[model samples]
Target: MDFQRTLLIGGLAIVGYLMILQWDKDYNQVPTTTQQQEQHQTVPSTEDAPQLTQAKQGASDDVPMLDSVADAPTDDTAADKQVVTVTTDTFAVEIDTKGGNIVKASLLKYPVKLPDDNEPNPAPFTLLERSSARTFIAQSGLIGPDGTDSKGKATYQAAQTNYQLNGGETLNVDLSLVDKKGVKVIKRYTFTKGSYEVKVSYVVDNTSSTTWQANLYAQLKRDNTQDPSNSSSSMGMSTYLGAAVRGKEERYVKLPFDEFEEEKFNADVTGGYAAVLQHYFVSAWIPNQEQLNNFYTRKAGSNNIVGFKNQNNPLKLAAGEKGEISATLYLGPKDQKRLAELADGLELTIDYGVLWFVAQPLFWLLTFIHSLIPNWGWSIILLTVMVKAAFYPLSAASYRSMANMRRLSPKLQEMRERYGDDRQKMSQAMMEMYKKEKINPLGGCLPILVQMPVFIALYWVLLESVELRQAPWLGWITDLSVKDPYFILPLIMGASMFVQQLLNPTPPDPMQAKVMKLMPIIFTVFFLFFPAGLVLYWVVNNLLSIAQQWMITRQIEGQAAAKSTK
Candidate 1:
């Protein structure tokens, strides 16, 4: 086959693969409606109820609690609960006194997109909110046989309604809840300067004569609601919006909202975390790694909850003794480096599809380039150049093969005419001609096949990188994550593809040649709605390939002309 035909087949295969991916994302997805989730909700049985294991004699060990507590008071009690507001450099959070739950959180550094007619300043992006149409909050408390928290029923009183980190290094806010049995539980939230991770600690004070035993549970609760900022055009390439977990056995597992409605997910692992993942942000509860823990996913009313709890062992605090259980709660963007430092496999929440092995290193290279250039757009261009340079030798060989095929086109056509009635004779003549020229018929395709994965991986890297969101290149091109509003980059890419095709041998098959002629138009139209950064990468790659192929073809043609003259 000719190089142009091979290229056409490869392009069609890629397009088909992408179409299948989009189809699976749209049609094959199991919808998880609010009604369906409600239907799946069932009352917890006694055996399934979380219990604190009995404390050993003279053993003062801490017991782990499940991630979520059931039967928490509904919205009716929210009116009675005091709202404590905590402000830091990066976050503005509201904690409810009812259960010391983080009822609302707003990212102070990130602003929501404003309407065209709106004022210049936009409000901060709210990650957790409690409204009629949406409800998302972080809840944590103690639950066990002798626990005061009956599914987070017990209410707490915050020391203050407003707390601020006024140029200070760290801020601490405490909410105290005392039950009728004289068990005191203090929920303390610790915030550090310029950090998204909050240190949540539950200090249990056993004042009663008998031993006090309970388990600590922390969970994230959020209703199924689509993000308002996600545009309709990008819906086909929707980002993952559900739960993710990382454990010792399972490196990274996703429990989408639909799967949660189908059945409950239960697992036991040491040093694992459960998080609610969205496009660029993640909220997770990181439990103590040394302790055995249980990861769970379930539906509660209109909310989907994913969390982890301590194992069955109950924490025992003797009379007049105090014990503390704590976990880190991270609520922020999906910064891969930061997430990786937080826990193993947490960075996988970025979701680079199945080609993560290639995509990850590509991302690292892009990041390194960005560190020096200070712009994601230029970093992408330079990265594309680096990738092309790395594969230049292979591509040069492929181009040489195509040049040989183009040189032999006349002889091959003559053979076809000589053996017009015999298919076997024509095949034998073509093989002899190829052998005489020392040409490999399949040489061009193998290099392309090998490089295809890297190209696809780079495509995903550009599509999913949050760093490029709302970033700008030169004139007209802004927001590399979105499509080019003017559609100029895609057109340039198509033009480059057409020129590259012209420099290679044309297919003999009429239908194949026609398809090859139309590939540029087809791909141009397809890429019109693709991300501008991705289009930029393609345009640059095509231009580079054209330059290389043209040079190689010219060099081979010059050498052949000199030999003929001799």
Candidate 2:
């Protein structure tokens, strides 16, 4: 085999990889119709309803205003200013000071929520809103008072314009609601300054003439309206946390539920619910386990109720009695180390799939390699080399098949001359000779076919693995998750394929040869749109394989020459 043929085959492999990549891009493009439907369905039905940024901007003339003032606080210096946000058109928070302590943060995940069970489609602007996924808001003008000697911790309860915490290392913020007579309703949230766990304790003093009963409730407001019926509609809730199939074999990765799923479940409960959407999987904590079976909903312009009701254990906060329901919310990647420290079953959100039995070890080894190299692209290169080395036995056999094909070329050509115009006789003679020589002509094809699945599995592993996203590889290539800006890697990949083709001996069939010749061109075009990281892996693998084959071919030629003399 010559280097050109080796390069050609390698180029084909890159092309093959790119073909899959481009098809995914063309057909599986983002900004789907489902998102648009969800956005459209979110239009306000009444004026009294909380005004969205759109309605306030006069973009929505049909929107009606409520007779009573909306729940949104008008006071710019509201105590929970961190939790309040106005639309770009209707409201804007003017931070008096920068780098201030964030007291009450309510990072709204969606732009708007619909009144009905219909979901809203996503707007391009809405998608852009999520570009800055991390939203943080805090109190301003408190820096001078922060480092004071008196308990420097900022308290959540105080409504003072400026606050200074005690000397304690941790601070607890509260969400207190007082009645007209200045009686506490909902207890304040005592969250540590920089932690997800909040120790919520409340003291409800009933100074009223009669005692009133209330239940402690927690709501995580989200928008789930979109035109789910439209296939083009792209709903945020669905895409944010939805199951996706991977690999050519269609491997499944199930997302966790956070909604009621029973048949008899009320529309109010089942219309829409919540579920945790992780970098990999989703686990939704619903009010009850029964909610899990009602409906697996994922359509835009349709309500997708998330967050189930606590079925197994529902805490009750009685009148004049205080009860606390505390849960540590996790808002980070599906990293195994970080997730392990959270709560029960939280780590399961990172779906490795059934192949995880083998894939996990492989992933760990690659991770170790990555930690040392400090570049995911290099990590993938290292991992591919290791995998190839492990499979060398089979690969060597495959290579030997090519070597044998090269050696038998002259003999096969002579035989064709001898048996000219006698098709049946020539076929019989070739089969007999193949059996006597014990040459496995099919050996090459078998090994290549066997490795194909492994290659595909690895491709999915790299694509879906969030750890590889935004991973760097020295210079020029910043994000492995996205395509390369310059087509250098892919072009090099094409050139390698062209070289591999030149190395491999030509087949007897002219038509087959022509088709093979065109493959590199087809693949080169395909690779133009493939993810840069994927193309990088193929380029490295091909370069290494080309070198390995060159050495092996020379050794085989030397052995054949020695045998021929004897």
Candidate 3:
């Protein structure tokens, strides 16, 4: 086979591989008035239903049951709805007084849409919601022999309906509950100054004659709703939208919603966590790391739940004794460093795929460049240049080989004409000419093959990093992590690719030449929907390649002309 023919087909295969990596994502956008719509849920609720009940009713399967224990009915099934709102520097959360559940939460730092200076402050992105369209909430309670939620939803009383933390290091929101039997329980939610992890604790004051024995359960219940925060949804480039658990053997295990019926996910995990992941954010239950807990995924009524429960022994307290049971809930962006600090393998949520080894270093370099330049777009360009420089020697050798091939193109064409239909003679003449010229037909192809993994790894880094969300570089390129609105970068990249091809020797075969001519156009259209950052990288890389190839080609041609004159 002709080496040029092989190279052209190989290039097409790489493009095909990239298209396969991207899958279509169905985006069912929520109504613009999600805030107003959330005020009244679609769930059929009693005029005076329990406050927590309204938020926990995404589906019938929202709550979990203990082994051999059925939940008993509650006396206040029609209790009035009541919630305590807490506002901090990083969060706006609503806690239901009934179960002390985090019924609604808004990430104060992130907005539902990019802010327009002309418009009022954009509303905070709603991370947890309770409505007919979306049901995602954080629920936790004591559920064992004498658990509050074991006998239906537990109700509590808060001192105030609203709380705020500003210029303070920490804030605490407390809800109190006292049973008729004299057992008092205080559910406290602790928030730090700028942290997304909220500690949900249950302080039990067991004053009853009998011992208080109950296990703590924390879980996230959500529907299979589309990820609204996914800005990387260009041409169906979707991120993971499912549950991920920390495995003893593996760093991360993905539990997709569609796999719920295939089998029940139940495991005894020590010092582990369970979480529901979306495009840029995740809500996780990082249980007490010291205790051995049970991590599970199951359907509650119509809801899919991923959470943890205490194993081995329930919290036991004798009469007149007091104790506490608590777990931390992280609800915010998936910052790698912060997530890694929260729990082991939490940072894996920022998935870089099989080439994480290569992607990790690329991300580090990209971030290091950003730290120096202070602009993600400019930083990306610098990173690309550095990457090109690192491979300069290899690229130079490949360009030299191509230049040599171009110098011999006319001679090979003359031989093809001389042999006419004698294919055997043509092959022998081509081999002798190549050997005489000391040319290795495969030389130019190896360099690109060697660099493919590195480039592919960079693709994932640009797609997965949340730090680049909404970051801008110069005019018209607002968000580096999203597709360009005007598509200027893709056009530039396409043109650069075409120019790079012009620097190479055109294939002698008509069919091969046609495919080579179409490559740039095909890639330009394919990149139209790619993230702006990725396209910027490609455009810069191609421009550099064209300059390098042109210089090498000119030098090689000059030397050939000198030799012919001699």
Q: Which candidate is the best by TM-score?
A: 3
lDDT of 1 by residue, 67-138 (tens): 433343222223466789999999999887766778778888765542224336656767876655467778
For residues 1-566, write the lDDT of model 3, one tens digit per residue.
Answer: 69999999989967764554343322422345455455545564332243465346422233455662223344445356598999999999988776778878999888766766643577888889776557788988888788887766788888899999978899989899888678999999999998999998999999999988988888888888777677455463678888998877776888898786566688887888898988789999998888888888876555677888885658899999999989999999989888898889988888888999999999999999888899999999999999999999999999999999888988978987899989888888888988999998778899988988998898888888888888898898888877776667877898898888888877867799999999998998788778898899899999999999999999999999999999
Q: Rank the candidates by TM-score, best first.
A: 3, 1, 2
**Greater-lDDT candidate between 1 and 2:** 1
**What number of backbone clashes does candidate 1 have, counting pairs of residues 3 or more apart or in separate chains?**
5
lDDT for model 1, on a 0 to 1 scale? 0.77
How far out, in Å, is residue 234 in model 2? 16
State the local distance difference test value for candidate 2.
0.45
Model 1 reaches what TM-score against the true structure?
Answer: 0.81
**What's the lDDT for residue 479 in model 2?**
63
Which ranges of candidate 2 are over 4 A from the true structure? 1-173, 178-300, 340-354, 410-427
TM-score of each: 0.81, 0.59, 0.87
Per-residue lDDT of 565 in model 3: 100
| Angstrom error at residue 434, model 1 | 1.9
Model 1 misplaced stretches (Cα beyond 4 Å): 1-79, 114-119, 227-236, 410-425
Q: lDDT tens string, model 2, 158-248?
A: 4433332344445444334445433453334343433333333334555444443322122222233221211111211122343221112
**Reference-based lDDT, each prediction:** 0.77, 0.45, 0.81
